[model samples]
Target: MPSRFTDEREITGVADLTPVQRDQLRAAGKLYDGEDLDAAARLVDDPDDERSFLGFCNLWRVVDGSEDRYDAWLYQVDSGTIFRAGTTDVAAEIIQFGLETRDPAVRAELGPALVEAGLLPKSDVSYPEFAGLLRTQQGA
Candidate 1:
């Protein structure tokens, strides 16, 4: 079947994934309009089958063309679901909530794991101190 990720090579695909799964793929630039969702689903499920999750969730500042990418990646994604999804990545999607969101409440709620994961510096994990450039600059 044709690939949904790009105008590229063909591969066998899996179907019957959830709407959110499809949304995640779409947000990450894995699937496009009138493309193959099944093939896109295959990329996330198969860890050893040579897959690359494209697109940057952090580019919500500059790239405005992709509403799905912007909304789903930067805001709608949940970090707890990352491990449950096996290989699919929501880390890029949800980092803003934990480390860079302007809401101190959100950072307080989600920043701990980011800090423990080494995504945040030890110094920045403190309340007055902040983790990312966006976090410090925009959040403050």
Candidate 2:
């Protein structure tokens, strides 16, 4: 699948970020890197900003690459600092990420959002079933 994060800017180091952006990553116990920089640029860009949705962006980036990266974003999500819901983009990203990873844990995390958005039926389906339903919804 093509990357949803399409802007391919090179981020050299933490020095390129604003102090607040640096602080947010630090507080989340995450280091600044190319992917983190990309996620930050796409998700959070201001100082002292508290947008929880960045967690999802980071999660989407790392889900298929590195477990440690995935864990860092998962921690950010569990930290409850970023709030994501009621938006088509957010819901869609979650669904796409879940489908791409095919990880039950990721699917379980996103399942409720899919159901709440009326994209999936409100039933107790297994992870694979839930993924299949999403795939069908996407016309895959």
Strongest candidate by TM-score: 1
| Per-residue lDDT of model 2, residues 1-140, tens digit only | 11121122233345565554344444433322223433344455554555323433332222222221122222332221111221111211222223233455554444533343343334434455665655654567
Can you tell me which runs of candidate 2 are displaced by over 4 Å? 1-3, 8-10, 30-134
Q: How accurate locally, in lDDT, is each candidate?
A: 0.34, 0.34
Give lDDT tens digits, candidate 1, residues 46-72. Answer: 445333232212111111123121112
Clashing pairs in 1: none
True lDDT of residue 42, candidate 1 = 32
Q: Which consecutive 10 residues in model 1 have the weakest lDDT in total?
A: 1-10
Model 1 off-target regions past 4 Å?
1-17, 30-51, 54-98, 121-140
Q: How well does candidate 1 score on lDDT at residue 110?
A: 38
Clashes of each: 0, 1
